[model samples]
Target chain A: MSIDDKNVILEIDGLQTYFYSSEGVAKAVDGASFSLSKGKVLGVVGESGCGKSVTAQSVMRLVPSPPGKIVGGRIMFDGKDLTKLSMAEMRHVRGDRISMIFQEPMTSLNPVFTIGDQLSEMFMLHRGMSRKDALDASVEMLARVQIPAPRARAREYPHQLSGGMRQRAMIAMALSCEPEILIADEPTTALDVTVQAQILDLIIKLKEDFGTAVEMITHDLGVIAETADSVVVMYAGRVVEQADTVELFENTLHPYTRGLLDSTPILGRRTAGKFEKLNEIKGMVPSLYSLPKGCKFQERCPKAMPICSEREPQLTEINDSHAVRCWLHIPH
Target chain B: MGPRERPQFTTMASYILRRVLQGLLVLLAVSFVCFCLFRYTGDPVLMLAGKYATQEEREMVRHAYGLDQPTHIQYIKFLGGALKGEFGKSYVSQVDALDTILERFPATFELALVAILISFAVGVGMGIVVSIWPKGCVSRILMSGSLLGISIPTFLTGILLVMLCSVYLEILPAFGRGDTVQLGPWRTGLLTLDGLKHIILPALTLSSYQLAVMMRLTRAGMREVMGEEYIKTAWAKGLSPAKVILKHALRNVLIPVVTIAGLSFGELIAFSIVTETIFQWPGMGNLLLTSIFETDQPIIVTYIMLTSCIILFINILVDLLYAVLNPKIRYN
Candidate 1:
């Protein structure tokens, strides 16, 4: 995408993940590729089970074992291959240069610890700061996140705080080290609409303040429209469309992408009727284990062709930066 | 008015108070049941008779301890004496019951303490190891071994150890009240440092099964906690596995494991009675056995109440600890 430039901080290519079970393997993420430039936001938009969050985890190599297997991928961050790093080496990158803000903030923070203990640990461990200094920095970070009465709140455990406060605390902790890239895996998915807007604003401000690249993984198309510079649309376990955010919306390269936009009730559009009810995409995201032969989306794609089921399509550039893997978009 | 707030302490406190009151009522029931059963089963007068005693002499002996009184009257007098810290005299030893127990308390406590410590260390350690590597052969073997430990009756285990390690090998003592030839003044053990020589076999017999039970519970606790999203979030934040397990997993897992441990302490007290009878370790277990053998009903009732009370008290402490570790809980 045009948004991902020379300052690219994280790049993932050809990632595949499968969950092993007695019934059969469930391929969670088949092959996906995208990059995030420094100080830019790449929104990964997909329905549930479309492997949007799995791609984010693959970059961090946080996938669980036995059931989860990453058969192919390269998570390139600042010239280093994260997938190849030893467990010890991965530790240095996980919280230092690259951090993650998980969905469901209430469950993300440690329930047994006070907010202060969880926060100070980042400074105490990474910078070898003294306890008092770490504590002060944590309090300062809390204030920066707009938490009211930061000092009093710091002493309270996770359960003591409200939903909005916990989300902010998670963002504050993630930004304390000022990482080069922040992977937010649906940070506001569990929050109410108003709180969701506040959290998104905080993420954007933090990204701009620290020049941190943000990978925003979410299912909400409205969030993508409001903030993302680039967008990657995942279908089943593969990326079906990748382009600059404006271009993806203005001239969508995949039929699935078009269906998603048409389904959303937007404010500006004046249609024939007051507003036709949203046309929900038919059928469910297919089980990844037995994905359609050529295109994972062909089973539901309105423009599905005979060849679409015969062979897998490669991610190919349709324009200077817009990429799509559908046969219909390929140059004939 | 904030969303996702914890319930107020007043509500949780009332719930906890109810639980505690119920526990006390249960203890009272246990006392009554033990008292009735003890009298119905055994002939205290006949058992109180020594190596040289005629039928007329046994009747006179029964009258001396007030066995001649009706059951209800005997209960009231016995209950009254217990309240005054007078356990009455042992029918056979002719010594104050409390004095005999006090003389034996430290020895029993020492053995139980050592066994408890070893149980926690070995059990939790093995549990963590197994959870970390569940598919490995060692995990399977360790977990299976713990189940076997829980199933085997403690007395049988004690007997088997005596036969296998003592009677055949003779490396560990088969039986003795500590190791001294002449029991000396109370200065650590009944017979100086030599008493340790006798404590070894009994302690091992006591620890093995306990260690197995603890290890099983610890493993399950660790597995459940490690699967939590917070743990995965910690990993993605770049925290090493060691920090994740030690700082996060251990503390959180201990909440349930600690309660189980406190409950097990009560079991240790019960198990010791059978264990001490077999191994002769000069603990409260041995004292209870000897007093029972001599049909000292007053002393028997006192010890039973004491054990039940200790259990009740420890369980209350455990519940209080739950509220402390989890601030969401409150005790009245």
Candidate 2:
């Protein structure tokens, strides 16, 4: 349960990111806490609006202000609280120490810039590399990511490349600086399945080669199962469960986590030539603007208890390697 | 690489050729409409001859100008003359119509260029400021003020500017392109200090609406691009906010802005009539207005054709710019 402070490159504690609109304040990421160990993949899994992306944004301190603000959080990275860092100080950490790739590779790289130009920017901005030197480094990075004819592809724009190639370019850019942490926020969600596999493999391979820590965010449990060392399951802006990937999959504690696991259709699971219906969780994620006072997942929990309706359960450690937020796990 | 390069070059060359052909077709259609409209407006012979003149004198004038010919014959003659770059002489001035319009064109071109440049610089700058700080008091004022720019008539704006700057302050020149210097065939006010002073009010008046449009477009575009995943990636890469916005977000925003700006530039040149009249700028707009009132068929037809040609050329330039700003856009 205790992680060495030295081993953890980024530790996010009690992070609360809220969005204020004319309608109401939506708690996008409410008190989400997790740590990303150095040179390991920490998967954050949740459905849309569950705040996994918001949590990642909060860590980067890239949340849009006014509409969205980080009300409170201690994003401890490199002996400094990121939330407390000045914009100027944050600039030093971003892309140089911590880099993030997004779900959309197509839109993530700038359309107007050549792949080399965009990749070279990281070098020029952070290392003060000259344009020519940065471009040379960009070609090397592209080649490192296995982009064929890297020099030629460097001259081309994002649109000239295929989806997988763009994602490779993104990975190449993100790893160009060999940052301490890389945040992959559902990085393969926008890609085709075959390309998705290739992109995921490329990310994993690059992580090994560079020894970079990764916060792999996705809604797909299969991706977490394959690539994550640990998993954080979020529901309605709250971290409902956290554990080692194998432990969480085997001993799913939170009812929401159980529901999520059940909903994922197993490959080749058919009964007597008839396809069995996938077990979907009974209800949609509670609206963030008007979340109930009780547990966010109470309405959808198959084994909802009376206590679940009265108060929300905190994420409590059930074992050395597992934590769950459910009245069922807590001893009365 | 050689084979690929050859095909791409051919595709681009063919694309340009196709666009130019389409432009020619549009010109032909426009010329036909102009010829028909001018022919039916009134009898040029009546206008040419005095009221006391005999019918024989009117007939002689009509014959002299070839106005007595059949409509089809006249149209063919007109087309043939236009193709030969000889649109005949203005009835009133007895000057070659094409030469007169061409002489006036530089004045209009100079004014439009100044106005568009001013609008582009200020508009895009304000847009960036407001988008970055949407809730700031300054941004709110700018947003509200831009509404006035959009709502007020161009002539009224010109008149108001004249009243405030010319009548009230009496600091700047009220009217006329002050002290234009002849540059070969082109007369340009841009080369002289007094001409530059005279241009301020009219250029400001002409630019107000376009500036408002560019501002709003840039603000919206920047806001949208700010939400893009790549921008987040840029920020996460430890780039300064300036670099993230100017380099990453602005480039993408400019793709659409360039399109609107190009079209607006064409419009500014064609539609500076009201501004020119108020300021007595002696641009194409002023020439066109006089020709229309005097029913100068040759000048009117030539002006229409020239304006259409300029618009077509600008549109082609805009398309080429699109390909430059966004690599995804290919004519083929």
Candidate 3:
């Protein structure tokens, strides 16, 4: 999609995050590029080990060093390249201009601290609010996330709250500063199905209320359908396809994206009064340490051409609002 | 999310009561072992009356000390006296054995406290430093130096310190507790300059091994905690690295480290025998050694019982600390 430059709050161009271990250097995110517009939800869909989470971590500058490093990337935000910002400068941007929530709410909150103490820490650190004022703000923020009896819940520890409640508390803490961009990295993946829907709704509602852009990373396309306006499909650390959610689903171009859609179980779709066998893409993901020179998806693509084994396909635009990476889509 | 009904107070109280009861049972078992040592180790009457005493006089001494009574009767009398805080007389000095040990306890307690405080401060500080900059030269040196601390024997460490600080340098005293200040019933070497100088060597000696252990534990714990989801959340919240390490990672690291520290403190108190002998410090270890050499059964029994008591008490303290450090640990 042609995103208006002024409306794009965060733009990631050619991001490369690699993990160096005793075995070898694993390119976790190679050439990932996407832009998040203001007050809109952008879904990042991929299977496990597809670099979706790493891309998010890179944006937050939270990648663990030594083993993991963002070797290349230009994360342009607010007229500055975030990747080049010093740690001190980045600290100001994080949680103030951009905030992130994680998948495992159960473990994402500090266990030793009370919910209020942890949430108030955000205000204390960035806003320089007094402890008492920060705590009051924490209670208000908790209430905004629809946590019942926010005042009492604030005094409780992470262990005392249910999974859903803890996720809400996490959301409350992330949104407390009213950040311009919110990154939810599979925010509801670890919760119950019912709670997942609630958390997603809460995020969407809060995003609208605060006019904050959101980058929602998850493997579940259903979540994208429910909350995302646009979707980015990633495979083997590369963005293979990008388009508006409805347009991409209606006219999916990438073979890998087609496989993902076919694999998902649909409601009320039966054959001979029995559920049909679900489709699954063939072959495991290529080892990141020793990826083949051709398309990363060549081994698994049902429609792979001989050229797919010779040259890696670059992301190519098929139309004004749709892009795909495949030999079929590219004029070669 | 409504007010979580916390019955924590009652559970906590009952938990403490149960632990106390268990402690009493352990003490009872220890007392039985001590009583066995008193009965079977040697004839106290023979030692007290000496080779020069007449047979009739020896019999008279045995009768006076309840040694002539049957084992069960003697045990009952011993148990009764123990309940009233009496532990018979020391064969060497003819003073109350319990009183003698209690008098020496202050010296050992003071030494142990100083040793643990020093070890904890320096060890944990080093651990934080190394964890933050695992590859820095300073961190590498500290880590390697900690290896030496762990490898060296306590007595050897004591002797080395004595040779360096006492024999070679001659700036600090190497032996004895020096001039002590009496505070109520407790005698301490902490308030006076001479006393402080005198304690430096022995305390350093006593702390070396514990310091190494604490350093390693904190380093590993901090490293592991830095990888936790919560720590990443802390960073994403726009917190400085210092704040994230100190507030988020350190608290979690302390959970396991505190348990070890508590146990290590007890160990320092019980096993400072070699250091005490090397430095001629007037601590319980010295008293216990002297009693063992002189075959002062009463003092030996009392010492063993007291050491067991301290260990058990520390265990309870560690358990309580776990509740403090991690809210997931309910007292119940």
Q: TM-score winner among the candidates?
A: 3
Off by over 4 Å in 3: A271-275, B1-6
Off by over 4 Å in 2: A271-275, A292-295, B54-59
- What is the C-alpha DockQ of each candidate? 0.47, 0.73, 0.73
For model 2, what is the alpha-carbon lDDT of residue B44?
A: 67
Report how far residue B179 has shifted in candidate 3, in Å: 1.6
Give the 10-residue window scoring lowest on summed lDDT in candidate 1 chain B: B181-190
Per-residue lDDT over A151-208 for candidate 2, one digit per residue giving the tens place of the 0 to 100 score: 9999887888998899999999989989989999988899998888888888999999
Clashing pairs in 2: A94-B237, A94-B238, A95-B236, A95-B237, A95-B238
* lDDT tens digits, residue span A1-332, model 1: 45426787888878777788887888788778888888999899999999988887877888887678788878889898888888888878887788999998888988988899889988887778998999999999999999999988898889888899999999999999999999999999899888999999999998999999899998888999888998999888788899889888889878888888888877655565566566777888887667777778888888888998888888899887799988987854
Task: Report every candidate's CA lDDT.
Answer: 0.81, 0.89, 0.91
Q: How would the candidate models be sorted by lDDT, starting from the highest?
A: 3, 2, 1
* Candidate 1 interface RMSD after superposing interface residues: 2.7
Model 1: CAPRI class: acceptable
Off by over 4 Å in 1: A1-4, A20-26, A265-276, B1-27, B34-76, B163-171, B177-187, B190-193, B330-332
At residue B8, give the lDDT of candidate 1: 55
Candidate closest to the true structure, highest lDDT: 3
